[model samples]
Target: METVTIETSDGMPVAGLRYTPQGRARAVVVLAAAMGVRQDFYAAFAAFLAEQGIAVLSFDYRGVGRSVPVAFRRSLRGFQADLFDWAERDYNAALLAAKAWQPDVPLLIVGHSLGGQLPGLLPDNHLVDGILTIATGSGYWRENAPQLKRFVWFMWYFAVPVYTRLFGYFPGKKVRKVGDLPKGVIYQWSRWCRNPHYVSDARGRPIRAGFEKIRVPFLSISFTDDEMMSRTNIDRLHDCYRNARMERRYIRPSDVQAARIGHFGFFRPQFRESLWRDALTWIEQRTADRNQAQSAA
Candidate 1:
């Protein structure tokens, strides 16, 4: 894995890591991370994919992890970034970088949670060949998993507002919620979660139009044991991609011979032999199918 810097269209230098296979790559994947989750969290998974002959690029959005500006390093107070920037700029940059890295190979995205939802926001999403979303869903609190509904309500109704106002940002690390986030991000995310339409309801954005524009192969993987994303939430988000050839799969722990595979457990190394192999097969199959279609055409 090589540490790299990706410059967003606005000239912000976001930090990232690129994992290249020793052999020629069959595909290049941009591993978009979940909300408030650092790119490093996917390091092990990315490396595993790399070892399987897939080139992977993982990056941090501007306000999180290595991309955090110097001024906001100590505190996110006055940091200026929202979910839109993360998608339009940071994620877009990663996609472009992956394409440039292996222009001849298939380009794919493996998005986790928020990472999965933002692909629609990219202006150049037409360049993508496929997307695989894990533990991704609409953030509407009302549609969340039963166990997390009330807690999500508390966080949205009370904690987010009070904490963001008091600290000039959502001190999630201190509060032990999502993780530290910029003021704009928490505020915008909270508003979306409060609304049933989620990002589509965001003030002036053409989010739904972007989703409709995506025509690539798309797949969503959700776990029965995921404590955060319910089947409804997952379906609601993917429903936005009306034009995509989309498929949804739900897995039970017993299917994978595991005790529990929650929202975050899919990427854990323990399930590597079982869960990871399945993901790799899907990616390879998608790439092969696309290649076959193109060759015939």
Candidate 2:
């Protein structure tokens, strides 16, 4: 594992780690984790991907993680809401960086939750072979409210915005209570919560056009009982990707007992091998088909 930095088109540096195999690889897989987790959070996943002889690039999005250039500007009363577009630029830069580093290999993207929605915004080709997203969603926010409410996490969207306006950016140190975030982070996030376009289906909908343009083969996987929202977004994706070979898997919690997993527990010490086994199985199978085609061509 080597530390790396990918500078996006807008000049923001995305901090990440890249893992390489002993020799050349046929393809590259770029992974995005839930929320805005740093590359280190995905260390196990990257290691396994390297073992499969596939290069992996996992980075922290700007304004979060180890990425530089923090957005300190808050709206005084709130944030301007436009800086959200910068997130897209970071995604583009990450993709460009992957291609730049290994110009000859095909690329596949694997995103979790919000990370899953990003690849849809990029141009597709032989350079990008396929996409796999786990616990991902479409633009529907309404479906997630039930769980968000049950967990008292709803305060994040409903109350945190108001708090940030008065306190500037709240520090993580003072967050003795839940639902508190940095002033800029909460403000920008609240804007995203309202925009569903960045996170949901966009098939000719008045909302977002980016999703309508995602035509690559996609695999959306869901646990039978995810601690978060149900697979509404995944279901919506299955419906919208009419032209792509889209598949969904709903693995039960008992399947979890057999799998011995919890939400976000896949890479923990107890479950690491099980996760590696299952994940590599999927990557190997899907990636094998892709490799054969490139070889035939």
Report the number of the highest-lDDT candidate. Answer: 1
| Number of backbone clashes in candidate 2 | 9
On a 0 to 1 TM-score scale, where does candidate 1 land against the true structure?
A: 0.97
Q: Give one digit per residue, the lDDT tens place, for model 1 in 1-297.
A: 999999999999999999999989999999999998998999899999999999999999988999998888999999889988999999999999999999999999999999999998898899999999999999899999999996789999999999999999999999899899999999999888888888854573436988899998898999999999999999999999989999899999999899999999998999889989999999999889888988999
Model 2, position 16, has a per-residue lDDT of: 75
Q: Cα lDDT for residue 205, model 1?
A: 41
Residue ranges of candidate 2 with Cα displaced over 4 Å: 70-87, 123-126, 138-141, 151-153, 169-208, 237-240, 256-262
Candidate 2 residue lDDT tens string, 1-297: 887888766565667778887798656878776654555777877787788788888787664556634454231223221223434666666677787877777677877776775565554323466777777665344555355536434545655655565576534335543222345555544454445443422232223355555566777767655655456645764554456677777777576466534346555655456655676666667667866887899
Backbone clashes (count) for model 1 = 0
* RMSD over all Cα atoms, model 2: 4.2
